[model samples]
Target: MQTNEIDVRVREILRLALKTDVPEEGSYAREDDPNWDSLKHVEMIFMLEDEFDVQFAEDDFAKMGSVAAIVALVEANHAA
Candidate 1:
């Protein structure tokens, strides 16, 4: 998928899992979202994995802290 498409889908997943709209300005990290607690982070990771049909390694989960990061990871996985 194109980067823009991946970005849209990732943002959708973020909205659903984080229960909030993604920020339009700058890179928004999980810590930036008050709603993104530990439980939600796990849930979000699972959702992203399922959505992209990609299995993220345990280390990858730690890297998924922002929209940009997730999109980049998903784009790379999608390419693979």
Candidate 2:
């Protein structure tokens, strides 16, 4: 999928999982965003996996802190 498409889908997943409309550009990290708590983080992972039809490795979970990182991970896994 194209980067823009990935971005749009990622944003939607974030909005659903985080239960808020995500900013166009800002920190989505659990450290910085109160909406990204532990439970929501896991939910976000599941949503992204289901949305992209790709399973993420355990190691990749830590890198899912921002939309850019999530998009990159999906792109990489989709390519593989």
Candidate 3:
């Protein structure tokens, strides 16, 4: 899938998992969003994995600091 396609799905998954509408600019992060707490972050990861059908490494969990990061991760995994 294209990065834009993955971005759309990732945003939807984030919307469901994070329970809020993510910004269109894709600059939001856990440190900046009050709704992006630890539990929601985990839920968002799981949702991303399920939506993209890829399991993330434990180290990758900490790297998901922003929507763009998640899109990049999924795009990389999808390419492989």
Measured on C-alpha atoms, candidate 2 has an lDDT of 0.89
**Over 4 Å off, model 2:** 25-27
**Which of 1 and 2 is ahead in lDDT?**
2
RMSD, candidate 1, Å:
1.5
Better of 2 and 3 by TM-score: 2
Question: What tens digits encode model 3's per-residue C-alpha lDDT throughout 1-80?
Answer: 88888878888887898788787665777777788888999999988888889999899999998888998898878778
Query: Candidate 1, overall lDDT?
Result: 0.86
Note the Cα lDDT for every prediction shown: 0.86, 0.89, 0.85
Query: What's model 1's TM-score?
Result: 0.88
Which tens-of-lDDT digit does each residue in 6-80 have in candidate 1?
777888888899889886546788778999888999999999999999998788888898999999999888777
Per residue, candidate 2 scores C-alpha lDDT tens digits across 1-80 of 89989988898999999998787665455666787887999999999999999999999999999898999999999999
Q: lDDT score, residue 40, model 1?
A: 91
Candidate 3 TM-score versus the reference: 0.89
- Top of the candidates by lDDT: 2
Q: At residue 65, what lDDT does model 2 achieve?
A: 91
What global local distance difference test value does model 3 have?
0.85
Q: Rank order by lDDT, top first? A: 2, 1, 3
**Residue ranges of candidate 3 with Cα displaced over 4 Å:** none
Give the TM-score of each candidate. Answer: 0.88, 0.90, 0.89
